[model samples]
Target: MCNIVGIYHTLPCCSSLTVSLRCSLLLSLLKVANYSSLDACLNLRWPSAESEILPRHVPKGYFVMQVLRRCPSNTSPLTLQHLKSVWKDVAGDLNVDESLLTDEDFLCCCGSSSPSVNAILGGVVSQEIVRAITGKGAPHGNWYYFNGLQCTTTVEWLPNSAISS
Candidate 1:
C-alpha cells in the first residue's frame, strides 16, 4: 500500500524531464515489492480530493480516461509466454523471464473472486495515476475488499463528488 504524489509549483508548463521523472519514480516504487505476496504486491493509492494549481492547463471538461483489462487468472502463464514471445519477435530481444509465470509472486492470485488480485493490482495502478495527475493527499494508497459470497463492496476512502474542484 504505497501512495505517491508529485507536485508542480509552477503553472502552464510541460517538460519531457517532468514526465520521465514521474514515470521513473512510479516504476521504482512498484519494483520495490517482491510481487510474490498476495498482500505485499498489491498497491492501492488515490489522488487528493483537494484542488491544486495545474502545471499545465488541462482543457475544461477533460475527463480522466481509464482503460480496463479483465484478464483470466488461469491463463496467466500462457499470457506471459505470449507477451514474451511477441516482445522477442518484434524487438529481437529476449530479456523477459518466461518462467515468471510460475513464480510464487506472479501466481499468488490464481483463484479468487471479489477483490480479486487482478482488481487489486488495477486499482493500485489507477490510484497512483490519479495521485500523480492531481497533487494532493497524504500519499497513502486506499484499499477495498469485496466478498463474492456476500456481494458487498467496501471502500477505504469515501467517494468524491467534486474530484476536479
Candidate 2:
C-alpha cells in the first residue's frame, strides 16, 4: 500500500513568488508528515482545535481547518509552541504583516486562483503526491518552483546550510 501523506494549502497569497513557494511547501509538508491528505480543499466549514488562533466566527468566505499528525517513530512532540515559532519565523522571512495573517484573514486568497491555473497546477501536485507516497519518485525533496506565467515547474533540493539554526 502507498504510504499516506498530508498537505495544507491555505493558499497564502502575499505575492506570486511567495505563493508559489508556499504551495511547494504545502506539498513538502505533506510528504514530511507522512499522512494522507485531501489537499485541504474543503468547501464547507469545520471545527478547529486551534480555535483561539482563529476568529470568533468564520466569515462567509472563510472556514476552519485543523490538522494533526504524528512523527513516524514517536520520536518528538509537535507542540503548539513549536508551530508558533515556525509560523513566526516564516512570517518574518516572508515580510508578512503577522497581524493580518490570522486564520480568518489568511484564507482570503484560498480560492483566488483562476480555474485554469488550479486545474493544471492541481494535477501536477496531485501526481507528485501520488508518486511520493507510492515510492514512484522520491518524496518532495525540500523546494519546488512553479511559474504559471511561463507554464513551467522546477524542483530544488534545499541545503541544510540554507536553513537557519
Candidate 3:
C-alpha cells in the first residue's frame, strides 16, 4: 500500500476536532517566537532549499516524561524523566552513539531533499500538537528515523512496561 499519513477516522466530533478530513489530509500550524496569536505570528522561509545534495537520514529521539491525568501541564519549567522502562530491553544499538550518525551519513545513503521538506516538518509537528491538546492520539515513541529526501518516516515504540517486565 502507498505510504499514507494524516487524519482518517470517521466519527462525529471527529473526536471533537473539527470535521472529518479524508484519507490523507496534512494539517500544518506555524508558530514563531514573539508576539501572540497564531495568525499574527511571523513569516519564515529558507532562502535556499536546494543546497542539500541528497536525502538526509535524521535520527531523532522522544519520550513521554510524564503522562498527565489531565490536559495541560501547569508548570512552566518541566523536566524529562527517561523512559528506560520502555526502551532498555530492545532499544538495541539504535541511538547508542548518536555522535557517529551525521548528515554526511544520510547523504551517502538517501537522496537529495527539496524545499517541501520544511512543509513536511510543519505538518508532522502540527499533528502531534493537535493530538496532545485534544488527546485524540498518542505522540511518537522514543525513537524515529526519517529520510528527508524520500520523505520516508519511521517511529520506534517500546513494549508497554505493564506488559513487559
Tens-place lDDT per residue, model 3, 1-165, is: 133333433333333234334321333321112222322111111122321211123233121111121114454322222223223321232223333333433232223345576677778778878876764644564334455645678753322111121
Give me the displacement of residue 163 in model 1, in angstroms: 27
Q: Which candidate should be chosen as best, given lDDT against the real structure?
A: 2
Tens-digit per-residue lDDT, 1-165, candidate 1: 223343433223257666667657655544121112333212111223321223122211111101002233365543434443443332222122233222232222333434565676588678877976665453432334443434455433222212221
For model 3, the superposed segments whose C-alpha errors exceed 4 Å read 1-113, 157-165
Predictions ranked by TM-score, top down? 3, 2, 1
lDDT of 2 by residue, 31-114 (tens): 232322233322112233322223322221221112212122255455544434444654454333345334433332333456
lDDT on C-alpha atoms for all candidate structures: 0.34, 0.40, 0.35
**Please, what is the TM-score per model?**
0.21, 0.28, 0.31
Better of 2 and 3 by TM-score: 3
Lowest-sum lDDT 10-residue window in model 1: 59-68
